[model samples]
Target chain A: MSIGKVGARKLMASFAIFLIATGFGMARYEIKDTPPNLSRFESTIASGGKTELSGIVVDEPDEREKNTRLIVETDNVKILVYAQHYPEFEYGDELSVSGKLKKPENFSGDFDWAGYLAKDDIYYEMLYPKINLVARGKGSWVKRQMFALKAKYLSALSKVIPEPYAAFMGGLTVGAKRAIGKNLLEDFRKTGIIHIVVLSGYNISLVADTVMRAVSFLPTVFATSLGVLGIILFAVMTGASATVVRASLMSLLVVLARTTGRVYEITWALFLTGFFMVLHNPKILRFDAGFQLSFLATFAIIFLAPRIEEKLHFIPKKFQFREIFSATLATQIFVLPLLLYKMGMFSVVSVPVNLLVLIFVPATMLFGFITGAVGMFSALLSVPLGWISFAFLRYELGVVETFAKLPFASFNVSNFPLWLTLAVYILYGFLIYKLNRRNTRKNQVA
Target chain B: MSQKRMAILLAGFIGGVLLRSFLNLGWAFAGFFVFYLSFR
Candidate 1:
């Protein structure tokens, strides 16, 4: 008997599932079997002596206020290097580094610093290495250009805006590598608005949305292509971190569906995007917290937001308040268990704090982007835009700091178990299933 | 296979990956095995 259309679709879906499962298994096996080629460096690390090694800086140096962190690659293994801010190094710098090599160790908290770095294939670390510049311009040219542009943009912002606000604007616009000070960063965490500063999917989606709207006057194909291009440029400009890549992939898929006139099935798109990402890099599946949070938050917004909106009839719908409230609540609820298990600090005031600050995020980002872009040409001309952005930044910082200072702002559940997190998600799945069934039955009766 | 069976199989595959990521290989293999037996 010949299989019908539906049967064929099901069969194809089953084949896809088989492929994904097999891919994951093979990836895990490969990671477990193959080891990093650190034969040359192992002796140097164990000797506990100052060793001189030469490597090209493979990635953008993470610049903070006092110091900078760089990933230097040599002998087919990556080493995380902590270097001084003076005589700064660029992304493609080739340097001779002399330092005592040490294995990355986990800090006091449950954070697995070693495993986190290992996910990126970084096994060794150098602290305050004496670096001698040997040469410049190594690694991918595109990445080098992106890093250069990002630095110039950040410098422009600093020229126009003041210290903390300028840094915050950089974080908002391009996921700036600079630190916003430990105390302010802690305030962001306590108030649960840290995602805004991290160049999250929300930021990428906002950019995508803006681009799509701006180019909507053009022909459909041209507009869609432009939107996709904008997404790619933004992803590249932000150093194309795993989170940015994932978000960009999702946005690209949406654009593709719209251009092809196919109904965008977001759930399938999300799953397929995640599957491909994991298939490419198995370590990230287990070790990348950014990947995990981005996936979960997107899933919650898609699946849980509407159900939450249904129950928020009492909340006014003005300014799309109800929609934002539900979406924020859905994401907060869905990510709560994971955050608690990983970070152990639950922001009791996260909902109110998020509600207060998130409304201004898009405007803040827009004004901040304008301020930086215009500042690049003329810092004098960018003053008005910088002022508007500074006002928004100041308000957001004030809200976070105020809430974080409250005695009951956040609670630390340092011992939150993995099992409990899993159980809570299972409960969430069950509730969603029940709600879907109820809605389907009501629709049938109607 | 029926649509219901197809959905279950897909869910099982996803669950296996989740287990592999969050727990360990043993749990993921066990999950895959259970789903494989059911599919067979």
Candidate 2:
């Protein structure tokens, strides 16, 4: 839809607000005055190099066990503690570490990873720190409970399914972890349908869309309100992650636009939510790869899905497969350039494989969620549902394996430059602007 | 493209994406063609 003068003005204002807020945030976090207690770390430990520091594990490891980054709190001074994946540390585990506290660094001719980390107010890194677990269960009660519940849910999936499939299901339900092994993950990466398992915005969108469709029969107002609330609740349940929040808000915008028929409302909704996310944690906009991809994918789907859907009348409307295919296509179109820019890989097999797998995602998630919830109560009931979920997971995994075996499945470019990515996006923006004008004219003439 | 021509072209494009993905020649062609049509 073409944004009117008023809508364009609103968008410009929102952009300005984002610019100001982000600028303020960058300064506030990066150079925000350090606490008095942290002066010891800055002067002696941070400057003098390797030292022994005892601290508590403030949160879960940053990544899958291998070379995980843990946030440690020692004497009101937080440090980025790195360790080899072992001894399985959890949130709230007290630890003593002896390591070099070096400053974060950036590689030349690449994205400034150090600047990205600085956005989180994290400046020091302790690589391969000597960690001695002093205690456990010292974290927040809510987070601990959430982790416990998540563990139990994943165990239920594992009980019903075999190795790699169970790992895939774990990813579909919870976020991607070490469940999928190194080989299978590489296969996933090569095939390029990894987002289904990455807990990315696409997965969140699937969840949101499922909720919206389930309640679509209600009155328009009620349906929109309920859908939005349900999505917010879902995000919170999924740890209220930046990625989840952005995806939910984007879906909520589409729901509101449907009920209100003010397409420009979407631009405002996107901007406002994105603004708040960056305002809450300015680092995510710059550093979080998932957040960047999620935002772009959601925007593309919102803008291009209807057009693709309009063009996709050939596919039978049964099972909403056409709708799913259009969405998957639209999102892939939007994300492909970014993915190439970042990962430098193009999967010829991506679209078809995604279509084969994504068609089953909603059903798989439904059965998987039901199995997890029910397994918490009645094992007998959940077992049958678990098997059903396992079957779907197996089919998707099979697609990945089969496609990944092809040498021509994917081709890698050596560091697709940032400049090319930017230029491509600029051209894409112009194309979309022209299409919007054309569509608006068509609507007017009609 | 006229309305009828656009309809036929769009159908061909979708077919290429779904059916000709084996070699990907048609799929790649369809993608660029769709980009052309989207902005034309």
Q: What DockQ, on C-alphas, does every prediction get?
A: 0.24, 0.02
Clashing pairs in 2: none
lDDT of 1 by residue, A1-446 (tens): 55698888866677667756554554454564355777667777667747999999998889876779999999778899998888988888999999888999998677888878887889899999899999999888888887787888899889878889888888877898788999999989988889888888888888888888889899998998888888888788898878888888998998899889898888778877887786667667668888989988998898889888999999999977898899899999999999999889999998999899888889998998888889889999998988888899999888999999999988888889988988999999898888878887988999
Model 1 lDDT at residue A313 = 92
Residue A7 of candidate 1: its Cα lDDT?
A: 88
Provide the TM-score for each candidate, comma-separated. Answer: 0.90, 0.76
> Candidate 1's chain A scores what TM-score?
0.92
lDDT of 2 by residue, A1-446 (tens): 55698888755555444333333443433333233355666676646787898888766565653677788887766778877777778777888899788776777555677655654566678888778878888877776777677778877767766777777887886664644778888889898877767687767878888889999999888888899887876665466567778877777778877888867456557666776676566456656677778878878877888778988878988988888788888888888888998777888888889888887887888888888788877778788898898888888889999999998999988788877887988887888778778888999999
Candidate 2 regions with alpha-carbon error over 4 angstroms: A1-39, A45-48, A62-68, A75-77, A84-86, A105-111, A208-239, A251-264, A378-381, B1-40
Ten residues in sequence with the least summed lDDT for candidate 1 chain A: A24-33
CA shift at A59, candidate 2, in angstroms? 2.6
Residue runs of model 1 more than 4 Å from their true location after superposition: A1-29, B1-40
